[model samples]
Each structure stands twice: as C-alpha cells, then as structure tokens.
Target chain A: MTDSPIVLVKPVLPALDKLGAALHEVLRSGVLTNDGSRVHAFEALLSARLGIADLAVCGSGTTAIQLACGALGLSGEVIVPAAAFPAVAQGVRRGSCTPVAVDAERTFLTLDPDAVAAAITPRTEGIVAVQTFGCPADVDALAAIARSAGIPLIFDAATCWGITYRDRPLLAYGDVSTLSLHAMKLTHSVEGGAVMSTVHPIADKVRRLRNFGIGAEGALPAGTNARMSELHAAVGAVVLGEADAEIVRRIQVREWYMDALRHTEWLRPVPFRPGAWPNVAAMAVRLRPDAPVDAPTLCDELKRDGVHARAYFTGRYRPRPIGTAGPTPVADELGKRIVCLPFWGGLTESDVMRVVDAIDRIGGGRCHESHALSLEYPG
Target chain B: MTDSPIVLVKPVLPALDKLGAALHEVLRSGVLTNDGSRVHAFEALLSARLGIADLAVCGSGTTAIQLACGALGLSGEVIVPAAAFPAVAQGVRRGSCTPVAVDAERTFLTLDPDAVAAAITPRTEGIVAVQTFGCPADVDALAAIARSAGIPLIFDAATCWGITYRDRPLLAYGDVSTLSLHAMKLTHSVEGGAVMSTVHPIADKVRRLRNFGIGAEGALPAGTNARMSELHAAVGAVVLGEADAEIVRRIQVREWYMDALRHTEWLRPVPFRPGAWPNVAAMAVRLRPDAPVDAPTLCDELKRDGVHARAYFTGRYRPRPIGTAGPTPVADELGKRIVCLPFWGGLTESDVMRVVDAIDRIGGGRCHESHALSLEYPG
Candidate 1:
C-alpha cells in the first residue's frame, strides 16, 4: 500500500489565464443568471464543439433530461436502462412520468434495442438510452425502434462529450441528446449540463423550460429554474476549450490500464466497439466469475491500499422488479461484479501501474491472506 | 431622457481580491461541485449569518422550494399567493402537488392568513407563504395556521434574505424556508438558492434529495441534481459576507425613492408593517386607481425615457383559476397596477429624482400627449 491515495476521478481544471479572463468578462457584464450573455456564449461554444445546431445549457445533467422530456411532451411511462446511474430513473420521474426499467446488453452495458422494443407498451411515452461508461451505444438501432414506436428518443450521453460514433459526434444520433458537464465527467462546467436537439422548436422549448418557461411573448408553459449562471458558464467555456486535448490524454491513460492488465486472468475490461471513439470517462473492470475476490472485496482491498475504488452502480441501477416484471439478469450480474478503478488526468503511468499491481496481487490470493490478518489485528 | 439607461436591478459583484482568492482556491483544489468544500463553507457561513442550524444550498430558488416540498413530504394541494412569482406555482407542480391560488392582502401585498384558512380543505397538504418583494410576511400567524392544520409551512423567502420579523430572521417562521440567490435578488450567488429547515431530519432529507437522493447507505428515494456549484458558492460566500451592509444600502435606496415620490398624487408605495425589518429587495409602486395612466403605460413611458421599469408578475402570477376556482381580485388588480422602478446599489439620489420626475410628469398628462404623438408617428 502506498501512502498517497489515488482518487476515482479528479476534475480537469481549465487554464488559469482563460478562466481569469472569463471571470473578468462576467464581472464586467454584471449579468449572472437568467440566460445571461456568458450562458449564451457557452451554449454557442458547445453547439459548435458538438456540431449541433441548437443547445440549451442547464443547471445539471438530470435537469437537462427532465427538460428534454418536458420539451418533447413526454408523459406516462418512459423506458430507461436498468444498468445506468440512478439519475436516469430520477430524471424520468422528475419529468412527471413513470420509469420502466429495461435490460442492458451484456457486451457494451448499454440499453439493448431488442429489450427496449419488448419493454414498450401502449403506455410507454418515451425512451432514454445511455452511453454507458463513455462507450457509444447502438443509437441507430434504438432510434429506429423509437421512431417505429412513435416515441421520442433521448440519448443520455452524460459521458459522451468527447465520444464519436463512426467519426461523427455521438450527439448527432438521438432526437434529443443530453450531455453532463459535471466535475466527474471527462469535460465539465464545474457543474452544468446541456440539452441539444436537431429540431429548432424542441430546442427552443428546452430553453424556455430552463428559464421558468417564460417565452418572448409571455409565459408559455410551467417551468422551473434550471439556468446555468455566468460564473459556471465562464468556467465551462474555459474547460470546454481544452476538452478535446483532455479526452486524448484520457485515452492514453485508458490504454496504460489496458496494457498493464491484459495478461491478468481475473479481471476483464469492458470492450469498446472497434469503430467507436470513446472518451474513456471511467476505467471500469469486471471481476471474472472464477476470480478469487468479488467486486466489493476488491474495492475494500484497494481502499486499504490507499486507492479509492468504487463498487459502482450496484443497488441504484439494479432495483427489485416491480409487480410481475422479472429481474434484469445481465444488469444485476454486471452491477455485482463491476468496479471503477482510479483513473484521472492527474494520474501518472506509475500510479496506474501501482493500482494494476495491487489488483493483480489481490486476485492472486497473496494479498487476501494479508488483509485477513490485518483485519484480525488489534491495530 | 438620459443617454444612460437606469436598469431595474444590477447584480453586485464581490470584491475582486476576494473573488480572485476564491478562484485560486478552486483551481488549486480541483473540486468543482457535488457539494464540495466551497459549497459546505458557504452553507456554514449562511447558516451562521441567518441564525439557522440547517441549510442546503441548491441550484435555484425554484429547486430549493421543490426540494423543501419533497423533504417535507408535501403532496395533494398546496396553497400559495397568486401575486407571488410564477416559480412558486412551478415549484409546487414539480414536487407533484397542485397549487391552489389565494389572494394577497392589499396592504403588504403578501399572502392573507384569512384567505389561506378559508382556502384549506380536507385535501390540503401544505402552505407556501412568500415574503412579497422582501417585505416580511405575517409568519407567526401563518405558522400558527399551519400547525393547527397539521400541515407544513414553506416560507418562500426568495427576496427576504436580510429581512427580520420582530427582530428575528424571517427564515425562523416556517417549517422549511427557501431563499433565492438569483442575480436579480438583493444579494445573489449568481445562480443559486438555499433550503433551510428547523427540523434536523427534514434538512438531512433535503440534502439527500438535492443530490439524487443518494445517501450514505444507498439511494434513499427518487431525487434530482439540484446542487449549488462551488463556483456559484464562491460568489455566494463573498456576496453573503457583505449582505448585511448591502441590505442597508438598498434600504437607503428605497428611502430615496420614497422621499422623492412622497408628494406624488397618482402613485402609492406598499407600506411595511411596524416592528418588521425589510430588505427592500425591490422598489415597487402601484398606480392609484384614479391615476391618469395605468401600470403598463407608465412602464412603457419610463422605458422610452431610458429607465427600465417593469410591469412585474403579470400573466404567470395572475393565472386563470384552474377548475371551478374564482378570480383572486386583489392579486389580479395588484398584478395589473404594480410596477418596479429602477433600483440597485449604483443608483444615486439624482437617478431616483430623475425617475420620480419622469413618473410625476407622465402621470400629470403632459408626457402622455407627447407619447401619444410619438406612437402616431411612423418612425
């Protein structure tokens, strides 16, 4: 165990000069929130960066999803991936709709198109598909299913800011897409998110929805205050300007983890599709069925080794089935076995090696006995 | 008309040196959001300043209200003043509750306790009382009603940050109180709010609800990401530190308006109750029923004179009664006649005199003929 701790993720700060300049602009303008100039500038910058025509910056990713649902007039039951973050389900409920969980594909851990199609009933109002762990999902297939069912498809691309599918931005896939700029993500606005849509009216509706639904003429609909302040947007503009480079650096970090653990028999990294360009937002590994230590056990071992590993998305993503609905076996198994390793831009190659070595030793059965002995000790 | 525009409200920027120091701390720490250190520190500072033990900073005032309702388990019908901001009704709807509108008292332009008591039915769940334009409401009376009815009282003290009721903080009255730190408020966080509760468990529930309901053990219930970012909190901390002094300055500005307009024949200001300390968040005046011009006409005239006066809270607050409800005549008339004049820290005595002189001329029938001529002109 090393003395210094390795955290699961660290926010990538923007260049000091750029951030200072942005703050200076905000101070000079004297406008802070309520769709101020800085928010407009950030929205313009993000729209250009993501190659989307229209984008609405919001207070958070969850609020972005809720606004998208409201803009699209979604009601009744909405289908979401059971293997995603709890925010996905929470956003669904916040939009005045019910969330019906569906199974995820075993390979990519994204919502399975077949399962979504099967889950759709006459009561289903919309579909929310996630790009799990920055891995690009089968958006085309899911979009086709949604279109056939005459429901809006919302791509929960919270981790897909720097991701691409077939050389185009992954944000181009869904009818309405949401991107999270939380600190934990590959790119951030300190704390913000954006809702993008190809349709101008829907994006306009989202803008109104973020600002109390007050339109140019008058109050259009009922809305809440989900606006990003100039202070946050200033930070966002600076961080987003450097996002592409950070994404490239994170890819190198992901490769370091993959190469270091390729020969290990106990852990398997989630495979990214060949043509998809992933941002590597999180470095997650699943314990093999025959592994010596389970996910929680390995997480505890890593914590003791001065590493902050997480047994990620366990109970939140795999809730007990409602009524006669059967459990999603693949998502449940993935939830039980998956752990997120410490991966951030601040980590050096040596740091990755230390984490890899610790996991390898723990899985080899040598460190487990030492851990048991430490647990038995009085100190 | 002057070349420079006198705006209705301007956000006060914190001291540059302090803001720079705070930004330096955030850059050094690389902690952006998720209730990080700055947010915790700001919450502590505000709780200490407000003399409240429990407070949770959130994304916006509307979200703060929604989180309060969710924390207090408010459901069914919630009573609210129809003269308040539209965000009040929006927040209730977001919390899965129906808002039953009630009229306000003509004297203070706040929720009438008698009206509220008469409006309560067997299905009533809670009461939302607002401090209209920073004038302290009858909190003790409202609290007594809520307690007798066994329902929670949420004080929407969005503009009452520095207000006190009988020398105590206005926040001390309700079961849960929410404050707005929006840019337009007397003191702002750029884009943020806070939820405070007297009950410890309710405050704890609010903390959980603000962060997707993910508690220490697991996800407790469905929640949304309504967290205040560190950047916003940095601004908040600085602004809050100077809030007391700022409130004093705003009160002086309010007095300037009052003294300048004291001799006016066609305008009347809302009076504050004795023994109550008001923050004077806004400088609003109502046109007398026998005045020469209405509120909208006067606002337009002021706008043409390079003063951005607002006919505030029109359609959203004076919404059509849902179902069989009758019109709230008092609130509707107030909404039609009330106008907010230019008020901010930067406004000088001369600026107040200019606005007062313009209003005096406009109401005296001299400026009305000129405006009518201008309207008839093609260019």
Candidate 2:
C-alpha cells in the first residue's frame, strides 16, 4: 500500500504527561476559566515570545479579530485584504462594522497599501491587513496610509505566528495584531487565539471585551464571551514552550519541498517577502499556466496518488454588500494558480519527494506565463 | 476564624484523577478542536442526559445564545427580560438584533408574558426568555405568545441545569434552550455552554454556525468561531456524569437556607414558579422596603461578618434602543430589593446558620412594604 496518505495538517502536540499534570492543578483550584491563573501564565508566556507588552488571549482567531475591532471602537467600514480567509471579513462584521475588501499585493498576496488607500472613505474606520500565508505585508506603507487617513491598522496574522520580518516579529507592525492558535497551525493551544497590541491601549480594551465587557460594576453591554478556558491555556503553555523549536522543524520541512521541486519546470515555490521568516504554514506553489494539468485536476491527481494537496482559499469569496471590493485582479488571478501541499513539522523528505513526483506524473502541457511569476524558484 | 468567609459559588468539581484520565486521551489524539471525537461524545452524553435529541456544545453560554440566534436566522428585534443577567441582552445584540427589554414577572423575576406581548412590534423576530436564578419562566404562556406572533422562543437556562418544571425539563418547553457551564455554577465544565432544541433542526444550524459556517465549499459569511475544544469536552463529560447528584446536594443546601430564615421578617425567599424544581443556583431573597439595611448595605455588612452576598442585577442596563422597554416597573423595583447569598453544592447547615446570624445582626429596621412581598418565609 502506497504510504498511508499523508494528511494535510498533523498537529505537533506537547508531551501528554506534561500537559496533563498542569491541567490537574487547574481542576484542583476549582477555576476553569474567567481569566484564571493558567490563562495569565499562558498570556505572559506568549508575551515574552512575541515581545508584545500588551496582549490578551482570545477564544479564537475570529474572536480576537472581533475583539481588536471592539478595542479600537471601530464601528464603521474597515478595510481588509480581499485574498484572506472568510473569517477575517466575518470578524469585522461581528464588531458591527462593514468590511471593504482591497486587493492584495502581487508579491506576497498581502494587503496592498495603494488598494487600501483607494478604498478609504469617510465611513472607513480602520484597516485590517493580513499576513497572507506567512508572508509579511507591506506594513510600513500600510501604516503610513493608515496614519494619513487617521485610522487604525490591525494585522490578521492568523497563519504566520513565530515569523519575523526585518529582525522583528511580523505581528509587531500594526496597531493591533491577532493570532490563530487553531489546531492546524504550526503552534496552537487547541482552538484558541490571542489579540496583541504595541500601540495605544488596545489590549486593555480587548481584555474587557473578552470577558463580556464586565467591569467592577457589571457588563457594559457591548461584548460577548471570548474568554479562552483554562484547559486551553494549560495546553497552550506546554505547546508554547516548544513553539520556537517546532517552527524551526516546520522551516526544515519547507526546505525539503524546495529541494524536491528545484528542477521541476511546472511549479515554483511562492516567494515569501524578503527577510521574512517562515512558519511553513502555507507551503504553497504556483503552477505554470502552460502546465499539462490545472490546479483542480492536479489536486485530484495528488489525492489519487495518496498525496494530500489543497488549493487553499479557493472557496467562494463573498464580501458583504458584494460591491465593497476594490478591483482585486492580483488576488483573483492568484486564487487559480496557488496550490498548497501537505506540510508540517513531521513531514519527512520522502513525503516531499512523493508530492513532487505526483506533480511530474500529472502534467503533460508545457506553457509558462510571464505575467505572474512573482519570483522564480532559485536553482 | 470565620470558617473561610462562606464564599459564594465554590464549584463542585470532578475527581482530579478521573478528569485527568479523560484529558490525557484527548492529548493522545492530538485533535484539540474543530469538532473532534471528544466534542461529539460530550454532545451525545449531554443529549442523552438532557433527553434532547438535538444539541451542540458551544464555547461559552454567551456564545451558545448567539449561535442559537444564528441557527434560527434571527436578525431584528428580539425580546428579553429586564431583570436578568446582562449577558441575556448582550447575547441578543451579538446575534445582530436589537433587544426589547420586557419587565420580569413580580413573583419569580422571570420574563412577564404580558410585558413581552406589549413590547412586541412588527419588527419583532424572536423572543429569548431567561430562567432567572434557576426560577423557570412561564414557558407554556411564552410559547403561546411566540407562536401567535409567529416568532421563535428561546430559553436561556444558564443557571438552571437538571431542574424540572411540572415533571418536565424546564429547558424542554422552548424552541431552543441554552446552558452555561461556567466555573461558578453548581455543575461546570470550566468555561462551556450548550445549545439544545426539540422543535426543529436548530442544532444542525448551530453546528454550522459554531464552525465558521463552513459547508462543502467553504465558509459562509454569517459565521464566527465558537467551537468548544476537546479539552473542554473531556472535562464536561466527566463533570456531566455527576451533575444530577450534585444538583440534588445543592437542593439540600437550599433547604438549609429555608430552615435558617424561617423566623426572619425583613427578608422573604423569591417565590419560584409553581411546580418548578430548584437547581439552587439563586438562593435569593428580597429585602423589605423599610428594612434598616437596604440590599447594598446588608451586602456590605455581610461581607464584614465573613459572609458573602450579592445584589443581583443591580447594574446600569442600556437596551440598544433606549425606548424599547414598555415601562418595566416590576423589574425596575425588584432590582433594588433582590440579594443573592453564598450558594454551592457543598454548603453546610452550619454555614447557612452563620449567614442568617449575620443578616440578623445587620438589619434593625422593621418597616414592611406590600408592593413586592412575593412570598413570606414560613415561621
């Protein structure tokens, strides 16, 4: 039997005994959530790792994005990347704001400053730039655009935790940044998230928002439950301790894919932003237009060959109001070309070889487009 | 010196060893969330125990309320009780609807059906009736009102689990019932919630809503992240096993409160609805208008005397449209008189006696008002 099909996302978990011991103590205290000590310790641990002084862990990435919007008091239209997960737009709406989708930049599939600037209007209250596929966005330019417009900039760095750009954590850029500690991510706390801020007192508001807006008096009526349970926090703490090393292992997995495809003419690895570190969350490659098989067909072939590959973010992208999107030509075009392969910290070199071989067997046509090369996979 | 101050809401937890064993199984699977097997098992366990065929565990009680709304596709004015926890109103708002606050019944401080009918408008989409302090609302009447108005009725049974009304589950009467498993509750799974429905396929919709509305294609725009983690489900399964018995202990503790207050004249126990069994979540009483110490002062004095008590629902409440209320006189007056004492499954007769002794020492005023004497303590 050809190797048991390598799954798309296999989580790298902490030692069972280690996480279990910490959880027993949580049960003994009779405080499972409502910002228990475990949650505090998990937050402190994440703060040290991300170097964020003001941060609050959230129930999920969508909740974190919504909390960030609540913290900033942004209730009008917010600018978001057109080429992002649907949760990003949903979170903006959850914060009682409409999302205006702007086209992503061609280089990194992240928010384009020019597109965001063009989409601004009197109703635009903020901007939520996404770190698409572990690729750093043009943060400085977007920040400048936000400053000129007198609006806040939030980064939905959901898929790019532990990644750095220009020697600084990529999430350290925007006014507020959110992380998704979903099970599929490189590092996770089992269905958890965090909202982080380096500018203003955003994190303080996020904390209040996470707890149903309850102050000393009572609930302020502008919040819902977004608290991460102590059980989640304990797992997070144990998993977080090994995140740096786990991320390094994921990086190694990405290189294995790079090595396997170096000589292939039909595909090239996505060019992440220069000086940006990779968490290997999105080990995607763009197919040559002239290749024998299309993205959907190739994905089918890979599945048949006992290899799992996905055309990530290829679902129906409907922004609310339907007319709020700026002409996202780059994002729209990239959707058809990019395909993500099974990549994780535990993925071996043989798995990468099997993936590349599946690609070689499927393609028969020989055509290459010059229009959207992004960057050539170096030989 | 004061028997550890008789604190309010000490959770009755499952044995550490039992919970830890289940949790370790979750760790071994490395599937922390996204509807893992553990979540499925926990939902099944809850469904069997509650005798509801359709149920879904949510991230928290607040999230459960919102998810139930999403499942029903409600988006306009929803009616809620004025004399209830702020989360009831907040959940309605989070569901993307403006809440119309109806006055609570004078007897049980639950939703008054007459007030609910008066508050309804052409824009009224649904009704959310709360089980205030484990006191069942007039479910049969509220259901009739909702049906005649062609709107759905939801029950927020956050504080009243395993309690019955007329030999039926208090939760079984509504279109959908939600529960809060917050740590302070008599039965808990740390920070968790559940949505239950018997009338329609509400649980199916809730499952989609909790999972970011992802179907075969991709995420629909109307969903946010509200999935409960496997870690939470593991703890819930164990804690749920003991909820029925623990609830019995809580009822016994409540009887001790009744016995201690038999001769008291300044306070009277809240008269719960007829044929309704108590979960003892709210061992609350209303102070006499002419009592020397009002609710707040009594609360303060109780604190000094090593007893903990709270003036439940005494905070500033602002319904979305300030004019949505239909003159909630009963609820407005009741807010000033109600007080919640220290309550839990393990409360002792001695602790109950200590609490009554503190109340006896604090109040010297003998004036009585006829407006809100729901019922008298038997002498």
Candidate 3:
C-alpha cells in the first residue's frame, strides 16, 4: 500500500476563503479595473497592516521591482545575491541593468554582507536583496553597505509577507521593498504585488512607472495598465484580513519540526537572528555529513516511502545567463543538500511525526538537541 | 429629481455569462497562475477560432506588442496612425523605438496607405496599423509598404475580436497581430491579451519573451513574466466559446440602431463598406452641422434625458518628442463631433430606440442617406 504523499506547500485557506468572499462583492459591483475603489481600500489595508508607510500596489512583484528600479533610474549594474530567485536578476535586467551576483552566507543561507560589499562597482546603481524562504534577510547590514556606497537597496520581499525583524516590519529597512502575493506565497491576491517605499516622491514615480509613465496628475502620462483589477484587490483584502492568525498557525507548525529534528545528526536548519520572527513559509532542512545517507539518497528514500521532499530552489540555478552561469558555492552545496519537507496549514502532529520518523530511519539520527552539530538548529 | 445616467457601453451578456461560468471552474479548481492547463487550452482554441496558425497569450495587448517587437528585434522609427489609442504610442516607446505618426483617412479612421508610405523614413523599421473601432484596417496596402521597405507589419487589432475582413480573419494578415481582451473590449479575459505570428521561430521567441525569455530546452535568456493566470484563461475559454453567438446578437442590435436612426438629421452613422464586418464593439455617430445641438451639447442633452453618450477617443493634440508637434486635424475634428452610444450584449432594442429617439428629438431633421440636414430648436 502506498503511503500518503506529503505536499510541499499549500496556500493558507483562511486567506483563500477570504479572497472568494471578497470577489463575490466585486462581481456584484461592476467596477472591474483602473485603480478602482476596491484597489484603493486594499492598498490602504495592506499598507496599514504591514506598516508600509509608502506602498503602491502594482501588478506583480517582478513589475514592482522593475518599477522601483526604473524610478531610481537604476541602470548599467546591480548587485544581487547568488542564492536568490531568477526574478531578482530579471528585474535588474528589465531596468537595463546588469546583474552582478554576490555570494551568499553559508550559515544563514541569505545574502552575505561581506560578499555584497565586495561586489560593489563604480557602475553599480543598487543592490537587490531577496528574502528567500520567507525569512528576514540581513537587510540592516546590506542597507548600511548600500548607504556608504551611495547606492539604493531594493528588497525582493516576495517570501517575507508576514515577517518582522528587530520589532519592525521586515520591509521597512530597505530603500524600496517589493512583495509578491503570488499563489505560492503565504498571502496571495491571485497574481499581484506592490512596491513599498518610505520616500513619497519615489513612490509617486513608481506609481507612474507602473501605469506606463503617464505625464502626471491631471495630465495622463503615457502609461500602460499596471493597475491591479478589483477582483485581485478583493482577493488581497481577504488575504490581509486573516494573515495574522494564519501566520501564528504556521509558526506553531514550524516549531514542531524544529523541536522534533533538533538533534538529528545529518541535517541542519537555516539560521535566523534572535530578534527576527520569520513567517516559516517553507520548512527547509539541509543534510549534514554525519547522516547515514546523503541528501539525494535520503530524498530518493523518502519519495519511495511516500514522502514528497523537494531539493529546494534548484530551478532558480539551472538557467542563468552566460556571464551569470552556475550557482555560488553555498547555494550549489545547499541546493543539492537541502529539501523542503511536507508543509502547509493543516498538517497534523502525526504528519510531522511521520516525516521525522522517516528522516531518522533513512539517515539514522537522534531526535535530541544535544546530538546536533549545527548551532542554528534550535531545540 | 435627477434621472439615472445611461452607461456609455455595456459588455455583451451571454458572453459575459460565458466568462463567469469559466471563472466558476477556476473557483472550483483553484489553479490560478502560470501557463496553466486552461491558458494552454485557450491558446489552442484561439488559434483554431481565429484561423491563426500560432498564437501566444500574454498579460495585455501592450505587453504583447512589446514582446512581439522584442522577439523580432525591432528598433528605429516606426510609422503609426496619429489618431489611435495612446497605448499604441506607449507600446512603441516601450519597445525602444520612435513612433512616427501618419495622418489617418477621415473616411475609415484608419491608416492612410499613401500617408504611411510618405511618412516612412530610411530609419523607419516597420508599420503599426490599428483596427480602429472594431474596423479591419487597410492591412493589404500596409503589408505591401512593409514588404518593400524590408520591415515587418504589426497590427494592433485590439478592437477587432471576432471581426472578419476580405473573407478572412482580420488578425491573420499582419506579420504580428495583437489583440486586447480588457474589460472594455468586446471579449474580455479580465485584463489579458495575445500575440499571433505567422513565423514559427518568432512565435517561439515570443513565447519565451512572455515567460522572461527562459526556455526549458536551454539556458535562461533575459525575459519578463507577462503570464496570464488560469483565472484569466478560464474566463477567456468561456468567452471564446460563446464569441460567435455574441457577435450575432451585437450585429442585430447594431442593425436596430441603424434602422431607427437612419432618417435622423445632423447625426451621421459610419457608412458601411461591402467586405467589412465590424464586431460592433462600439457604436459612434458624428454630429453634423444641421443637428439640434453640436456633439458636446447633444451629449449633455442625451445625458439629461438619462442616456449616457460619451465622446469616443477624444483627447487634446499631443506632440511627439522632437522639433515641432505634428498636426492632428482628424483627431481634432473627430474629438468634437463623435460620440459612443450604448452597445453590448445586455443592451435591449428598446434601449437602442430610447437613445435614437433622444437624438432625433434634439436634432430635429431626419437622418437620411442623401441631403441630411441639421436640426435647430429655440430654448
């Protein structure tokens, strides 16, 4: 008999249900597009909820990043983390800039401050720090480096929707932050994103850029329809409403995994700073040398045993441009060794036990904190 | 007491319902994004329905135009119709080309071939012909000019969905034809569009371009995500399925308006051509000198009578970025006289008569084929 295969991720249902209810109102009201009433309401709600003082909702996170770059007049070169999603590089390129990949920190699996500082060039207009796996990146250090270098910092916070760092919303530190509410994220507006900045003037420029760089207020500048539809806005409002409870539930689920696998010999979880509270969007673990089996072998074994573990972020590395070829050593190593375990909103303690037991059986590890080699894996 | 104002246009219903039913499936499946199965299915159906061999869907018509230009490596100056949607000019600019406008024919409100040929400079890379108000443009002559100039012909068929010209699908004649499926169009995918091309290689490039220039077969080139979500595709599939019937219904309503207003004075309906069958996406009538009131005054009168009539495609003369602004006589004249009346699937024949009766009462003379006179009444 086949075991129930665990899913990698599923959208939080409260948010999804909220979207449906919100859309019913939209269908009844015929205001479908063009910065309508629903869109305005959603923007206000998102900005207030996320503490984004200067946010303009746009079409997608990619578009958001592109608009931010366009507003900054960023061109020629941009420093991006080697471990980030392809969209980070793509966004830079969209602004007619070159993506200069910086190495990532081995311990944190996020952008390394030292590597980013070293990658700066006279041609560098900015740095794009991507918040990978729903975790708060080291934006504070990156921001300082960018400030000293006289360059802007753009946070691709596509994964850090409900996260905070040092008692502040995660998106607040960067010069500009872009968020994706794509279906895979913790919150989704079907397919939508926004560009948030503390600076009002840049926010205004981004608004114009998103809408085809229209002339200005009262005069229609030549702009395209970068405006999100009411349907999408309605969905976003619903997602925003139930995000707090959903995040709490997700954090609780993440805690179980952290506790159960704290002492496993062959695995290490990603590191986060003490003051940072992550969304735990995806539960990722790295295979260590002390394990009985390597990552690939363990992954095969898990699949055969009906567990659906995926090599995390492999697709992001496979198809980079010629000059931007191959993954950085940290990402290359982790890309092969790391796996995102069965994750979602409703997985039971039994499901967690099943995953833990399977990991222990295949890799031969103790389930106690004292047995772990990596300090990052919390008890 | 104020009367309820008439809407300028209404979406054809059975068609809108068809779209709603498709959305119902999306609600059930929750497959919201990427080149999902529904998007793919819609692409296939559109290819068959439009009689285009290859078609690829994108986020919007402007994006499709940009993608087509990007895929074709189009650069330098391009000739465009002066009196068209501002988006066409914006699209050309986004594609990194200078748009050179040719005066349109007063009769067809389309690109005048001789004018297009005269305006073409040695730097001109192509011609962008637009199908205005659901009318098939003079594509054959434009194609000849493009051929002689060794440049491709692009058609902005944003309003020509379900339209036929010369016994062939209007979209099939150009090198690259783009269609808009915004909420305002005859058929809507809730902010969507597609690009159809005759050349397979270019079509393949366009597909990659829409997807951020990444190919599954090889390395990732620079690209953007102009992807249409499953929600959009689901709605598109349902609309495309019912497009024919919707077109027939619209034509019947259009005929009713034509018969009712055929003898009204000072209001001139666009004359029909033998081979041109428009989608009737919008109905416009120009105010003649003999009317009871001019276009603006008549429009206000209609509004007071609870019929909402709007000036179609009316904007002040905009100059290109250069030495001096080119003249816009057609746009200037049309801006003052033309108004769009209520049309769409949901509007009834009685609604059509109400508008006609309002116009006839204001513009006292009969709208006849020969010797139409303007009407005047003392206040």
**TM-score of each model, paired residue for residue:** 0.93, 0.93, 0.81
List of chain A TM-scores, every candidate: 0.91, 0.92, 0.86
lDDT of 3 by residue, A26-68 (tens): 6667667767798889889988887776788877777777777
Q: For model 1, how does the per-residue alpha-carbon lDDT over B1-379 read when each residue is reduced to its tens digit?
A: 4579888988877777787777767777777788888888998998898888888888889988888888887768889887877788778777767788888888888898888888888888999889888777787788888989999989898988878878888776688889998878877888888899765456677778888877545554347888888778888888877777777788788889888877675687867777777646788788787677778778889888888998766764333333212457888788678888988877888888888877876765543443443222222
lDDT of 3 by residue, B264-330 (tens): 6567776544587864767878777555566667778888889988664454323233211255567
Docking category for candidate 3? acceptable
DockQ of prediction 1: 0.46
Docking quality of model 1: it rates as: acceptable
Report lDDT (Cα) of residue A23, candidate 3.
61
lDDT of 1 by residue, A105-191 (tens): 888888988888888889999998898888878887998998899988998999888888899888777888899988888878888
Pitting candidate 1 against candidate 2, the one with the higher DockQ is 2
